[model samples]
Target: MNSFWAVFKRELKSYFTTPLAYVFLVIFLFFSGYLTFKEGFYEARQADLKPFFVNLPLLFVFMVPSTAMRLWAEERKVGSVELLFTLPITIVQAVLAKFFAAWLFLGIALALTFPLVVTVCYLGNPDIGLIVTGYLGAFLMAGGFLAIGCFFSALSKNQVIAFVLSVVACAVLVFAGMPTTLNYVSTFLPPGMVAAVEGMSFQVHFDSMQRGILQFQDLAYFVLLIAGWVAACAIVLDERKAS
Candidate 1:
């Protein structure tokens, strides 16, 4: 436990010291502001944050991989992964600590967008419940994507490859419930199987919660997704250590 906490704190603090964190944050804020302004013009809805939340999955699809790509890939590239392996912690503990650190970064990014909420409230009587739910959906999806990103990060020592792999995985998940994907799969699979795949999409379940409907299934899906991927990362790391 001590080792886990140590790793978590160290990783978290390392981000702020490096220029990477500041650069990414600046770019993220720029895009967030741009999207918000664009959404405002197109929707012409004063009190709704529909545009901001609508672009969340897209924003995270790229932002998250940037963070995760460096987690293991950079460490391995510079041969620091060996130093980490020499510690007292197990691979699972390290994986969880690293994952939580990345998730916390995303959480802070989401929190910094509070001005959007204030803007909506100042303009009209917007539903805070929906706003809360939208942020919740965004945060959960970020964690889930980070897990997926972490898996790719462990696959190689090349940060570029890691980033590209995570992006591809995220893209598939983001579009999992889209009509095109489902329609294509519907031709080859049974109706029930196709429906099940659609249900498994992050967007399908996220939409319900983003609209202020807190469903247990959506919550469980994210929890399970994160757990599954983190566990996979640990197993991979352990296998390499043993070999």
Candidate 2:
């Protein structure tokens, strides 16, 4: 437990000790706000932050992977992974620590968008519950993206390759549930298979929560997605350590 905290703290603090983190944060905040406003936030004149939440999955597809691509790839590239493995922490502990650290960092990025929330509230009497659920859904979706990125990061020593693979994988998941994608696939695929694929997509579940309808299945989807990918990441690192 102590070793886990040590590693977790180290990983979290490392984000701020570099200039890249700040640069990434700046870019994320700017685009988040720009995309929200660009989505007719003012023109629509709605008190809700639908525009803000709507762009999260696409934004996270790029941003979260970039944040995660370095988690393990840099350690491997710099040969520090050997030293990391020598620590008292188990592989699973290390993986969880690193995942949590990155998840919290993403959460911080999400939290920094609070000004948008305030703006929505001031403009009109919006459904506070909807705003809360939207944030929750976005945060969970970010975790899912990060988990996939972590797995890809563990698979390669090159950060660029990891980032690219993560982005492709995340984009596929997001696009799979889009109505256009499903309609196109349904033209040839069996109905059951199409349903299965849509169920597996991040969009299907995220859209549910975006509307403040938090079903058990939607929540379970994200929990399982995060757990499954993080476990895969740990397995990959363990194998690499053994070899």
Among these predicted structures, which one has the highest TM-score?
2
Q: Residue-wise lDDT of candidate 1 within 121-182, one digit each (tens)? A: 88898988899898899899999999999988887778899899999999898898888999
Q: How far out, in Å, is residue 52 in model 1?
A: 0.9
Query: Which ranges of candidate 2 are over 4 A from the true structure?
Result: none
lDDT of 2: 0.93
Best by lDDT: 2
Lowest summed lDDT across 10 adjacent residues in model 1 is found at 234-243
Residues 183-234 of candidate 2: C-alpha lDDT, one tens digit per residue: 9999999999999999999999999898999899999999999999999999
* lDDT value for model 1: 0.86
